[model samples]
Target: MITRRRSHLRAWALLGALLGATGTAWPAEAHQARAQAPALCTSSREPALAARMSQDIAAALKDRDGTVSVAVHDPGRGLRCRLGDTRLYDSASIAKVLILQAVLGRAEELGRAPTRLEAQRMKAMITRSDNTAATDLWQKLSRARLNRVLREAGAQDTVLGHDRYWGLTRTTARDQLALLAAVSRRTQALDLMGQVVSSQAWGVTAGAPRTVKVHLKNGWLPRATHEWRVHSIGIARGTGTTGTAAVDYRLALLSHDNPTMRYGVRTLEGVALAVHRGLAGGTAARGFTPGHRISETPDGSVPSGAPGPLPPAPPHPPQEWGTFPGTVPPSRTARDRRRAPRRPRSRPSE
Candidate 1:
C-alpha cells in the first residue's frame, strides 16, 4: 500500500509541473498575439478618415480666392493635417486668443477670475475682434508675461513682440490649432480662454443658431496695407440644446498675404463654413473663390490665370498694430538697425 501511494504521488507531481509550464507559456502566447495584431490607428478606421480630411483641406485651399494656410487637429485620435508651410501669417484678430490666455492666467495667478469690467473688455476683444480692447489687454499683459505663458503652455513656435506692431508677435495656424485642441479638452489653458470670452460685446464666430461653442481669439492689423487677415483658434462644440454632441475638430487658418482685397471678416466666414462642412462630412467647394476680391488698375480687376503658388508669407499680424491683416514685420531691435540700409554687404578687400 505504501509503495502504491508513493507512485501515485510522483505521478501527481509530474502533472502539476506540466500544468505550471503551460500556464507560464499562455502569457507569452498572448503577448505575441497582441504584437502580431494591427494597431487600431494604423488599421481600418482612423488612418483612412485622417487621410480624407487631409485631402479635403488641401482641396479647399486650392479652391479659395486668396492665399491661405490651414491646419486641423483631432487630438483624441492623434490626427494632425496641414496644407501649408509653418511660416507666419498676419495674425489679424487671432492674437486675441493669446491676449485672452494671458489675462486669464494672470487672473488665475491672482487667485480670482477677472472682475466684471475686466471680463467685459476681454469678451469684446475676443468675440467682436475689437482692437482697442486688444491693445488694452496687450499693454497689461506685456511681452515678458506672455512669453512665460507660451512657454508654460508648451507653445514652441509662438512669440510675442512689442504689442503695438503687426510683426511684433508671430504665431502659426498649427500653434493656434494646438492651443484650441487643448482648450477643447477643458485643460487649464482653456480656462483662460473661457474667462475672456465671457465679456465679448459681440460674437462673430459663434453666431450660428446651432451655437458652435467657440473659445476663440482673432487679430487684424488694418493700419498697414489695407489688407486684412484673421487668426482664430477654437473648438466648434455642438449646441447642447440642439442635442448635437460636440465634435472634436480644431481649426487654425491664416488668411492674408494673398492677392485678394476683401476684409478679414469675409475671409473668416469662408473658413468657418469650410470647417462646418468638414464636420458634417461634406466635401469642400470645387472651384476657387478668393477669400477677398482685389481691384486691379482701378478697373478690370479680374486677372484670370492659374493662381500662382502661395507667396512666401510672414506670420499673422498682432492686434496692437493697425496694419496688414496677418503679416508679422521685422523688429527694430538694435541688431536690426546695425546692418547697412537696403544695400548689399561689401566684400572685405582681398
Candidate 2:
C-alpha cells in the first residue's frame, strides 16, 4: 500500500511538471508570433476621426495598383496619418523644391541674398518647372551644398541625384513632409513656393478649399522600370472651425507603377480630396475642382491659343524641361507650336 501511494504521488508530480513546461513554452511561442506580425495602418487622432480617415484613405486606394505612400500632419487637430510613409520614390521634378530651398539656404549662408539672376532662375525652377534653369542652378549649387540644405531641413532620407540628374533623386514621403513643413515655417521659402505658377497647381490643390492658401510642388516621370512616378507635396492653411485655431496642414503623396499619368493624377486627387474633407471637416460639395487640362512644360510658357503649325526652329533647339509622360491629358498651352521652342527628340526623364 505504501509503495502504491508513493508511485501515485510521483505520477502527479510528473504531470504537474509537464503542464508547467507546456504553459511556459506556449507563452514564448505566442510572443515570437506577436513579434513577427506586421504593423497595421494607423492614424494618430481621436478614435472616431482616426477611424474615418483611415477608412476613407483605404477606400481611395482600394482598386489602385503599384505602390502609394502618404504622410499628413495637421497640428491644429494634433493628428497624423501615415501609410508606407518611409518608402522611397524617384523625386522627378519635385526635386526642384529642394533645389529652391538649397539656393535660398545657401544664399543665407553666404551672407547675401540670391543674385538677381539666381532669383529669376529660382522662380523659373519652382513656379515654371524650367529644366534648363534647374540644371544651371544645380551646377551652381553643387550636390554638396544641396545636401547641406537637406540635412539642415531634417530630411535624412532624401538623396541628391547623381550625375546632375536632380529628377532621379530618391526620397521618401516622410522626408518630403519634413521639407514641406520647413517651407511653411520659413518666410523666404514660403514666398517663393507660394508663387508656383497657377497652371502647375493641380494635384493637392485640387482638394484645398478656395479660402485656404496652398503652396505646392508636383513631379511626374514615366520610366521603363516603374511605369510612372507621380508625386505631390504641399501645405494648406485657413481659418479654423472646430475649436481648433487656424487650420494648418502638410501632406506628401508619392506613387509609382501607374498605368498612365492621368490615372496617377486621378489617384492622387482622390486621396487628396478625402484627406482634405476628413481634416477640414468639409463636405464633398466644397472639395476642390481640378483644372480641365494639365501642363507638361516646366516654364509655364505654354501659349494661350489654338494649336498652330510648328514654329520656326530657334538658334539652339529648345531643351526639354520637365515633360510629363505621353499619358497626361493635354490641358494647357504655354506657347503656340508655330512659335514654341523645339524640345529635344528624346523624352526627358521627367
Candidate 3:
C-alpha cells in the first residue's frame, strides 16, 4: 500500500513539471505570454489612454511588415505615448527641417530673424522640401555649428550625415520629437512648417480634423540595406476646440525595412492615424480617403514616370501616400492618360 501511494505521488510531481514547462499549468499559457510581452506604448499621464493606444497601435500593425517607432506628446493634456526603441534611421529630406532650425538658431543668436537669403532657403527647404536649399544651408553651417544646435534641442541621439550628405543623418523618433519641441518654440519655425505645400502634407497630418492646425515634415530614403526609410513628425494644435475636446498634440513616426517606398509611406500614415485617434481621448479613428499612392521620390518631389497624373492624382486603384505624395502628386495629365487609355499604338508605314 505504501509503495503504491509513493508511486502515485511521484507521477503527480512529474506531470506538474511537464505542464509547467509547456505553460499548461494552472497559471495558464495566456497569462505567461501576457507577462512576457512588454507594453508597446505607454502614457505617463493616463494609464487607460496608454492601454487603449497600445492595443490600437498593436492592432494596426498586425501583419504589417517593417520596423516602426513612434512618439506622441501633448503638454496641455499631460499625456505622452511612446512605442518602439530608439533605433536610428536615415533623416532623408527631413534634414531640411533640422537645417532650417539650425539657421533660425543662428539668427536668434544674432538678435534677428533669418537673413533674406536664409529666409528664402527656409521657405524652399520647409515648404517645398527642396534639396538644393537644404544643401546650401547645410554647407553654410559647420558640422560643429549644426551639432551645437542639435545639442541645444536635446536631440542627443542624432548624428549628422557625413560629407554634406545631410539627408543621410541618422536619427530616432524620440530625437525627432525633441527637435520638434525645440523648433516649435519659435513662431517662425511653426509658420514655415505649417505652410508645407498641400502635396507634401500627408503623413502625420492624415485624417486630422481641419480644426487642428497641422505643422509637419516628412522624410523618405532608399538604401541597399533596409530597402527604405520613411518618417513623419507633426504638431497638431487644436486652436478651434476648447477644453478636453481639443486634440492638441505632436507625433513622430519613423519606419524602415519596407519592400518599397509606397509600403513605407503606408506604414507611417497608418501609424500616424492611429496616434491621432489615440491622442483624441480615444475617439474613433477617421479613415484616410483612399486616394493615390505615391512613388519613389525620397527628396519629397514627384519622380519621373509615375503611374498617373500627380499631386491631386485620380481617386481610383487605391494608391498609397508616399514621400512624393507624402511630399508631390501626379499631374493632371498623368490622370487623364490613365483614364482615357492609350488609344492603341499606331502601326504607321510597317
Best by TM-score: 3
**Model 2, span 248-291: residue lDDT tens:** 88999998877677677777887898788777654333343343
* Candidate 3 Cα misplacement greater than 4 A, ranges: 1-33, 239-246, 281-286, 289-293, 300-350
Off by over 4 Å in 1: 1-45, 63-65, 182-212, 222-227, 239-246, 260-274, 280-350
Error of model 1, residue 16, in angstroms: 66
Q: Please give, for residues 200-219, the per-residue lDDT of candidate 1 as tens digits.
A: 21122433334444455544
Over 21-52, each residue of candidate 3 has an lDDT whose tens digit, in order, gives 34333223334454344555555667777666
Q: What's the distance in Å from true for residue 314, model 3?
A: 53
**lDDT per model vs. reference:** 0.50, 0.69, 0.71
Off by over 4 Å in 2: 1-45, 241-244, 283-292, 295-350
Better of 2 and 3 by TM-score: 3
Candidate with the greatest lDDT versus the true structure: 3
